[model samples]
Target chain A: MAEVEISQLHKTYPGGGRPATRDVSLTVADGEFMVLLGPSGCGKTTLLRMIAGLELPDRGSVRIGGRDVTYRAPRERNLSMVFQSYAVFPHKKVADNIGFGLAMRKADRAVIQDKIAWAAGLLQLEDYLDRYPSQLSGGQRQRVAVARAIVMEPDVLLMDEPLSNLDALLRLQFRAELKKLLTDLGTTCVYVTHDQVEALSLGERVAVMKDGEIVQCGPPMEVYDSPASEFIGGFIGSPPMNFLDATLRRDGGEAVIEVAGQRSAAPGSWAAFAEGPVRIGVRAETITAHRAERSGALRAVTEVAEPLGSTTLVTAVLGEQRIKVQVPPDFPVGAGDDLWLDLRADRLSCYERDTGRVLVSDR
Target chain B: MTAAGTAAPDRAAAPDAGVDRAPLARRRRNRMLVQVACLAITAFMAAPMYLITLAAFSTRESLNAFPKSFAPADVSTETLRSFLGATGVVPSFLNSLVVGLLTLVLSVAIGTPAGYALARHVFAGRDAYQLFLLFTRALPIVVLSVPLARFFITAGLSDTVLAVALLHTALALPTTVLITASIFTAVPRDLEEAALVFGCTRASAFRQVVAPLALPGIAAASLFTFVLSWNEVLGAAVLTLTNRTLPAQVLGSLQWSPLPYRFAGGFALLVPALIFIFVMRRYLLNMWGTTLR
Candidate 1:
């Protein structure tokens, strides 16, 4: 319903070390789901809280629905937040919990009742209307929290890791349900989480943050396939991207990249770098592992192989570097097996060895 | 020879089975010991009330009889009736009730907000303020009573239920603030934030979300305030003369009165406190039973 614009937001707690957020700006399109994803202590939650009007930024303005709401209180902002703890009122029954916001607005009793019923039905909580929160399981309490937020029909919805408290299996189910529910409702949402998979699956666009700054923000696959920095290439993938030390040299008409004593031609974009040393970044799944010795392939000693139904993750040592390689589930390899790894040239990313910034990307 | 050998092994195996039974028997014995100790403590606490009620309802002559019977024989209401009929006794009893109720109201009214601030905010000197409250309690009432009485006289409020109530409030506020702060602390901050995000203002959020959860704790503080005000004699005695509470009014005359009247006065004072505790028992249990989510 409302697009949120946050600009130049900075917040530093008293007795501060590093600021919680620094010069952060983001715009969430109307009805678009934006996920702020990062590890703990990375300031993603701080940015979300600033947008919610829960925490005041030291220097920034937040505009929601084209209105300047930077100084407004949370209730005045016409937004609802689902806390990580669910935070359902324990003293109230599920019906009252869902109806709290409408009651706060002094809605008509009949309308409040209708809205409560609709939300309960939507959340599959009709049978639990009369039950106290203590009687509900973790997942049910979370549903009650979601029902409460949606019943208000606020301009925007803010969720701070709302699914984190549930058991792993319930988190997955609720994650899917939440995505479907929010999509059906078409409410502009800003979700904060430390989960990469949740961000990759649910977000219309994922904003990955580190050390109080947005490192990369893009469509999930775009960010995954073309991480802007070495930090991101390692952060976004399962088993993460592998980084290997390599030397780059001009070999006549082409740049030759050497890793672990094996040589391959660099992508054409790398012709600009007067090569000495560079880091090679490759996804685990992009490298093909062969049992036989192959020409133009680096040899690695497998340390461990984890069978994960669809794929086997093999951690192998090539030279002094440890790298993960995704192989077929039935790949016949185990500890101490020799594997000839063919690093696909099209999928490889080259980064500056000292700066960890990408020098050349295949795409 | 085979029978002897088999019997020897069976005897050896019997001790292994007894080893398991030993701990079970010891556990049962320990449980019985705990039950017995609890019974003994209950009797120890209840003995005085039994004796006082028995003595209070006895005929005046039976109290002075040569062989005092523990059984309630020759029961009469003569001494209790006379005690109630004593000049200023009923009035002082009413005064005590007013003072206790007033103390409960005033302490809770002033203490709850301070408690909430302590629980919710991180102000400078917060820890020092808490320590100051505890220090105020360390000062004996005997030291504060005369000055407090003088201050009340100067304000033209001496010798009234209000004066006694004010002194009692001062006495009870530290515990009231501390107890309610702990109660409020147990209510999650997340609930308040959720209320704020859901359309409730700060005040309404507190009233709707926090207060209901903290009600039992507030009740506990009120109970403590009432009992402290009810039983306190020195401060009441110092602060009031004509508007004396029950304990203050009786302490002056009862020590010189006959034993029956003394017993009657003691029994009269004990009943109201016991009744107050009985009334607030449910809320007190709720305070203990609460488990935060």
Candidate 2:
């Protein structure tokens, strides 16, 4: 395994109006599982391809294991990649596909056979060694692709949305196995995916990207619990974080904010922004709901309730703004039912209205 | 009011179901008539081949009799032996085989890489070049043979099998390029890229992964080019005088041959093409049956 360093990387197609990736830089430590996550066309895959030497950058350099490899061919880079299409050779048997890299490197025949056997055993593909790729299912083909990359035992492994083609159940099952496998091998990896769940589960450090730039990069929980920007807040969560416009005000020596004509004391960090317009971001799970009417709570009528077994998600409207609140599934609620939602002060994040950057917190 | 108005039509239409049977029967009869017409046309096109084979195998007496019998009276080797023993006939047949094989090699060797580039790369004037290939199809071989004959004479290549083969390559190249390009396009690009990432150079990737997958398409194109060159008459006749392809020699000497020899020559000329198709049928099936997925 080796550390990878990229600096000031930029790439643009010949006739593209905008660069696919611009001024991007990142460092992945040895054996680190760094995931590049964003929506489609967000340049995550482009950055990963640049690191793999499959794509050349317009400007900037990449260094792996302290050696500059910006202009090296993909084969000379000694890096392996699992394509999103699971590009295992359809004409080759599974064992040959897994041993292809080894054969290219002129490995001993015994060693190639041994490695193929180990990979097939690890992937539970022992019975399929002699079968061509066309005979395998989608999940099996993806496993073959992984086996092909891992058998090389390269210093770095790159995966681009490898699980995106599998069905949801298979994706979930394979992702856990893949996470275990990567950890076992301890190979430095750069994975690109648009799936938030996969990013959260698979990445040791998640780099949230947008418009060819990194918006946030940190441990998954840190980036999740404390997103750096409104875009990160919305992109990282399921039933994403809710945002509401409010103006800070002073009431009886304390800072307060009003929502749907109901006023509540704001966190003390907002004292400087009294009478300033700010956007509040609250996670759906952080919002508490009470069946009985309570004081200092925003009154709303439930518009939709989705029961997800243990926790029910309730989407409701307070005045003109809509908010999603996750409550206990056992809590009785229906469409048009009046419910009171309490936004926890500690769980709320405030951002400047126009800039969308997080408001400074004193803690 | 609209619901009540629509309900009345449903009751009125219930008794009209029997009226549909007559049209259905008529449609079935019409389909049967079309099938019979197709069968008749197929038989009409196929009958000449059957009659020619019968005549080629019949005894001279049976063939020349006043009452011409359509059936093969008796299987005889005398007529075939006479044609095979004719001076220069066997040599012409060998020349046809040599020209066909040479043309197949030249066309594929030059066309495969051009087809690959057309299928894979984006270069300036690529679309225009492809259109030009298609446009060449409109030019007749007779028009090209005249200029080719002049060039061959000046180069001292006239009356040689190589001369005929070269002309045939020019005739077959456009079809070869278009067919091989489409075939190469069907082989996925990702497989080659995958090989490259697995420690192969670009050339090795194509040799190891792509060529094997595209073999069926290549085989089909080879068979097609061979048959085309084997059967071409105008270019073969114009380019060669002494070293004639079988078709050219047979047509040139048609008046001098006896009736049995003419029939035998016609049947003999078809033998190699039939053998080529028989040998290549499997590859053709693979090419058109299941697409590369």
Q: Estimate each model's TM-score.
A: 0.92, 0.91
Q: What stretches of model 1 exceed 4 Å from their correct place?
A: A360-363, B1-44, B65-74, B282-293
Residue-wise lDDT of candidate 2 within A268-302, one digit each (tens)? 76776647778888899988898779887888999
lDDT of each: 0.90, 0.88
Q: In candidate 1, what are the lDDT values of residues B25-86, reduced to their tens digit?
A: 56666766777788799999899999999999999889999788999999899999999999
- Provide candidate 2's TM-score on chain A: 0.96
Error in Å for residue A81 of model 2:
1.2
lDDT of 2 by residue, B163-203 (tens): 99988888889888988888889888878888988999989
Model 1's number of clashes is: 0
In angstroms, how far off is A59's CA in candidate 1?
1.4
Give the distance in Å from residue B206's predicted Cα in candidate 2 to where it truly belongs.
0.9
- Candidate 2 clash pair list: none
